[model samples]
Target: MKIATPNDRLKQIMKERNLRQVDVVKMSEYYQRELGVKLTKSNISQYVKGTSNPDNKKIQLLAKTLKVSEGWLSGYDVKKELVVSKSELSNHFDKIFQSDKIKLDLDFANQKYENQEHKLTFLALLENFDKLEEDKRKNLLHYSDVLLESTYQKDEYNIVATMFDNSMEPTYSEGDRLMVSFGFDFKFGEDYLIEYKEDILIRRLFFENYKILLVPLNDKHPTTTIILPLKDHFKVIGKIIGKIKTSP
Candidate 1:
């Protein structure tokens, strides 16, 4: 007969997701870096113990990190799911591609193909590309290279690299072929292949206070922090735009 409090909802969701206070601490660190909201293990413990409540900005950060709705996290009688708007999705895509040097010309493709069937065929080819035999895959790759060479001049952005480590696992596997865009423009919250201290590594970038945080997706790996004004210590090889899995 008692109304649930924000602490109660937070405890419920954390229990449901098997997230401990320490896990929240680590996860909230990521949001802290991205959203510039400060959170600590002590804060999480206080919230869990119902001794303190998070402010609006902290509530928003928690909701995003926990993949729940802010209203639900705030103990409102709303659905727990987070509903993302189309504009939000559009803005996310814009943030990714707006700074890229290579532009995908979907309009040009439509104009050249002209027929819906042709578009469908191209889609089918893309869908079945990985399923093709080794010889067929080579042939397709050759054909693609020929088309691209004829269409556009080769640039440094044409670099493609294969993942040889599990440091970025789950999101990118060991054998995945990463399509890289060569640049030094480090966008926060996006993954990039970087060269630092003579080692080439892939990490998600973030800027906090005046430090650059290079975070690995696999938490087992350590996050590297560099001081501002990067200097000669850091070099960005490229940003990872897309990837191809070697296996199904």
Candidate 2:
């Protein structure tokens, strides 16, 4: 028995897809245009030969182009398919609704509302509800619940989102449910969920004179700094008030 390496997975997928090294290089160009990352013929050759491994960004691009899971491509023993079953999605949402932290009224659809805006929104959703696909309807209902919870809840922390990376390891691991409050008043030494360019990151904040530093708890990741005047693309989505740990 032998352990599978990324090289093995890469070769396996290439063979399955009937793709050549040149084909991969050409296909990667399409993703590079959008991701602004380069993957050359040499990079692909080295990856297949086990001479080198692809970095995180390249791994993502490769996964998307090759149509496989990042974990699987990285040689992890996981499902190759990225698709989630309808039952699994339903179970995930059920956990959210059943959580004690959330107080979303499930019967809002039947209850009468005095607010004209709320009434109109619910009416519109009801009118077009049947036209939407099953998955879209579920997403719309979840969005509506979150929106209502944020609007009516007295607490500052109204939104709930899952942490997707290990950048905040020890303090917050991946799959942890983060209770985030929407605000722009950034306090130093606090953890925040921020939108930097196209990526959402969870980082601890530190102010140094005229610069704002985004520091990760995991020292493997380097700290990012932004000057006092934030760029148009940079935005602080919210402060992380609390987190529900999913793993021990």
Candidate 3:
């Protein structure tokens, strides 16, 4: 009744699971560059031959990437995914990755799959804009973060959107939230919310030849809200793509 060693367990799992060497190799492809230069089939064969052992970091990623307990590799996983985000907190994770995050009261999550490709993560938007402050009749320039130079183009992307008591009511009312596409230069087909001389407007942009149009929602009251076209009196503050509403 003796306990099996880590390597012993590794050999056992490989055999019982009927896993091929290439199976492990293909898993490693996820971080081929970070773990080291891209590994070829020949390199994988070398590790199987015992003539070469993967580097420490490489081995950890290899084991985790393949869902094999690290114990099966470095003799023990009594350890973890060894996360180290670049200072930017922006360049570390991939387009999609399984890693970690500090959320609410959870002490530690075994895994947190991060998706970077999402223009703006839905959860992030929800958390930032759950409630609104009084005296603020508009959302423009509120939670907005201007991007002067980002890899993606779509200026003024909405990170947080809310809908309640807004001129956009009936169509957009209480308890609605939206995900926005942002960071492209101002143009038509793009709906922007701008404040002119401190007056706020949530409207769509339409350019017809030499004229421009800024149309608002709920026009039953009509001219009470002035409708203008390319007036020298205003500037483009921002655009509204989507919004979410919470209890007023």
**Which candidate ranks first by lDDT, i.e. highest?**
2
Per-model lDDT:
0.66, 0.67, 0.43
If ranked by lDDT, best first, what sequence of candidates would result? 2, 1, 3
Candidate 3's C-alpha runs over 4 A off are: 1-158, 161-166, 174-182, 185-187, 221-233, 245-248
Per-candidate clash tally: 0, 0, 14
> Each model's RMSD to truth, in Å?
17.9, 14.6, 22.2
lDDT of 1 by residue, 1-248 (tens): 22577899989988865678877665555457567898888999999998999889989999877767788888888877676564653443343333221223333455567787697755654454446687655433432211223233333344455455567878885534466776447669998977787566788989999998999889988999998787757877788877632211
Error of 1 at 199 (Å): 38
* Error at 49, model 2, angstroms: 36
The TM-score obtained by model 3 is 0.29
By TM-score, rank the candidates, best first.
Answer: 2, 1, 3
- Candidate 1 or 2, higher lDDT? 2
Which runs of model 2 end up more than 4 angstroms from their true locations? 1-131, 139-156, 183-185, 245-248
Residue 242 displacement in candidate 3 (angstroms) = 2.2
Q: RMSD to the native, candidate 3?
A: 22.2
- Per-candidate TM vs. native? 0.37, 0.47, 0.29
Clashes of 2: 0
